[model samples]
Target chain A: MSQLLRQHIEKITPLTDSEFTYILSHFTPKKYKKHQFLVQEDAPVPNDFFVTKGLLKASYTNLNDGKEHILQFAWEDWWITDYQAYFNETASSLTIDCIEDVEVLCLSLHNREKICAELHKIEHFFRRKSNAGYVALQRRILSLLNSSAEERYHQLLVTYPQLFQRVPKTLIAAYLGVSRETLSRFSK
Target chain B: MSQLLRQHIEKITPLTDSEFTYILSHFTPKKYKKHQFLVQEDAPVPNDFFVTKGLLKASYTNLNDGKEHILQFAWEDWWITDYQAYFNETASSLTIDCIEDVEVLCLSLHNREKICAELHKIEHFFRRKSNAGYVALQRRILSLLNSSAEERYHQLLVTYPQLFQRVPKTLIAAYLGVSRETLSRFSK
Candidate 1:
């Protein structure tokens, strides 16, 4: 557990055993089987999970047409949650479903508040992470506005090459705001 | 100046005069005339500006078609910057222009680093701000994927009604991934 957690933190900042333990104390470990739903739309989100292994996709379906859009994908070392619900304490508008059997380090809003109140440095670490997430989403919005379907597909390949293999092509196509047919043609 | 700075801090967390003064000391007052560029595409961005008066728009243009997309609009009490550039210390891909003659409080990377190092509470405040920003961007991306032109326009109005009056119709339409004509029709 420490090894997996350390690998994730090292991507952001180096942590000593004491620091890692301090952070680890706030999280609880859990495992889920493939096709498990971590969160469901319209339900309250109680916790945010950090992926230790396997894959998960956060998605939402349009009420009018019932078409689903993949909002995000998480592999090892990534965090997954219905962020809108997590932050605002509202009913979730998205669902997080496991694509592969998974292990996660889960932290609830209660634990998170305690950590922020007690360990301020950890708060700083999360702040930096959130800033990076914002930057990535901003870039995605810009790409949607300016890039062609082909360009976005190429970008996904460049940015998250691992995602192509880990996620189904149909989900990847949805993520790129294109049809699977378009993605198939682009891949060729 | 203190009142404005205090208001900014209180938006996230309450701070005493000494704490507010300590934070304010790190910000440098800046002025830009109408149409002045605060940041340009492919240029280094070193600071985030807090608007004290007037307004600004952060935007990018497509090289192929010369079409522009407005990423965000900043009014008094709001923060603006090429966040991708500021946080990453990379050349900016977006440019920020003074949409109206403006006065701003600028915080450089150096000062921000010092604040994070010396004032732990400031770091927590920043973390909360970043979290909120990340949530907003995530919602925006989801809207782009699932919402229609009119739905998006309506959502935008519900989210940022002040922006409707302050920004041009074309810029707002572009941000919503629509045309000015379509936005006009939707608004009616």
Candidate 2:
């Protein structure tokens, strides 16, 4: 599992074995059963999870109509958290829960900052990650604003075929901001 | 104008006079007339602009319908670019144009990486900026998925009241993914 993290980071910035070990010491590993919540709305968010196994989702539940809006999903080699809550040190406005029994390496904001301040390479790695993540979110926002439901469905299918296999149709509909029937039609 | 960039960076990490001067040397000051495009779709994106004066928007034009969708607006102390193109060194997918006559400090990808590699504090500043940007994009995605047009209108009005004064109603409509008439109805 730690090798997963090492590889992920080394793809951007190579690390000496001792340096990787030092950085790895800052993270704690944890596990969760299926359907367990890693983060709950209005609770403080302290850690960002880097997934090593299984699948999970982060979502916002609309209070007025009780509808779920899927924000993101994470599986192996992915990261998940209520990042706004984590960075701001505020109560979360999203819930994150397991879609499968899960294992993740958790890094708290304190340790993240500590390691980033201590290591220039680690800081560069995170900066590059954040830049790429920013670009992905920008593309997603453009898709939501400009694409038709069918277009969005096709784009998702092309971008992450594995997601269609792993996620439920209803959850996929929520992520694409379409009705289940609309998604069904596109899939057919 | 240089002070704006210094202040923006200082908000995250304090810099010495010599450090700030060295960083500023990497940026070139440029001006654009209103309606001029900083970035054109399908053209190489060479620099990211830090706004020192006036306003601009980053948007995509849907080819089938010829409708524009606003992705972001930048004013004083804000950054704007085809970030996807800028980061990846690809042809732009979006067009960025000035809404008002604009003055900006431009940083190419090469200089950005150079400064970040050379200065740990600059890397920290950029990482923090990118994280904040990621969180803002997440909030926008949630709003797009969950909120009504009126709700989104009110949220934008509260968040950036000055935009209402400076940007045209039609552009505001594009930003909110609503018709101009619908935006007027909400404002009334």
Candidate 3:
């Protein structure tokens, strides 16, 4: 698990073994069974989870309609959290739960800041990650605004083909903001 | 203009005058007239603009329908770019243009990386900014997924009331993914 984190970080910045070990000490490894909640609405988000294994989703549920809207998904080498809540130290506006039995390394905001302040390279790695994440979200927003449901389906299929196999069709529909029947038409 | 940049950076991380001057040295100040393009689709994107005055929008045009989708708007103290193109050194997929006669401090990717590499605080500032941007985009995505056109209108109106006065209703409609008629109805 530590090796996984080291490799992930090293993709952006190289880390000596001792440095990797030092950085790894700030994270606490946690595991959850399928369907277990990692974050629940209105609860404090204490940490951001870096996934080593399994799948999870962060979603917002409409209070008036009781409909779930999928915001993001995380699997191997991805990070997941109620980022607004985590960064702002507020109650969560979304819920995160395991789609499969999961293993993640959890880093609290305090520890994250501490490590960032201590290691310039770690700070660089995080900044690069955040910049990449921002670009990705921008692309998603553009897709949502510009693409038809069918086009969105095809785009997602081509971009993250693994998602089609791992995520249920219904959830894909939720993410794409299309009805299941509509998504069926697209997939067909 | 330099003060604006310094204040923006200082909001996240304090800097000495010499340090601020050193940081400002990496940026080139540029101005654009209303409707002039800072970035055009299929052109290389080289700089990320920090808006010191006026407003600009980043948007995508649908090739088939000849319709536009507004991705983001930047005004005083905000940063705007074709981030995907800028970060990856690719041709732009979107167009960024001045909404008003604009003044911006342009920081090329090379300079951005140079500063981040040389100054840990600048990297920290950028990381913080990116994290906040990620959270904002996440919120926008959630709203797009869950809210009605009317609800979204009210959310935008309340959140950025200045936009209502400054931006044309047609562009606001574009941003909201609604018809101008629908936006009018919401306002009424």
User: Ten residues in a row with the worst lDDT in model 1 chain A?
Assistant: A116-125
- State the DockQ of every prediction: 0.84, 0.97, 0.92
Candidate 2, residues A1-188, lDDT tens digits: the string is 99999999999999999999999999999999999999999999999999999999999999998999999999999999999999999999999999999999999999999999999999999999999999999999999999988998999899999998999999999888888998899988
lDDT by residue for model 2 (B1-188), tens: 99999999999999999999999999999999999999999999999999999999999999999999999999999999999999999999999999999999999999999999999999999999999999999999999999999999999999999999999999999999999999889989
* Residue B58 accuracy (lDDT) in model 2: 99
Residues B1-188, candidate 3: write the lDDT tens digits: 88999989999999999999999999999999999999999999999999999999999999999999999999999999999999999999999999899999999999999999999999999999999999999999888889987999999989999999999999999999999998888888
Chain A alone, TM-score for each of the models?
A: 0.94, 0.99, 0.99
Cα deviation in Å at residue A179, candidate 2? 2.1
DockQ of 1: 0.84
Enumerate residue pairs that collide in model 3: none
lDDT of each: 0.87, 0.97, 0.94
lDDT accuracy of residue A91 in candidate 2: 100
TM-score (0 to 1) for chain B of model 2: 0.99
DockQ of 2: 0.97
In terms of lDDT, the best-performing candidate is 2
> Comparing to the true complex, what docking class would candidate 1 get?
high
Candidate 1 lDDT, B37-146, residue by residue in tens: 99988999999998999989998899998899888888888889999899989999999999789999999988997897688778878888888888988888888888
For candidate 3 chain B, the 10 contiguous residues with the lowest summed lDDT are B179-188
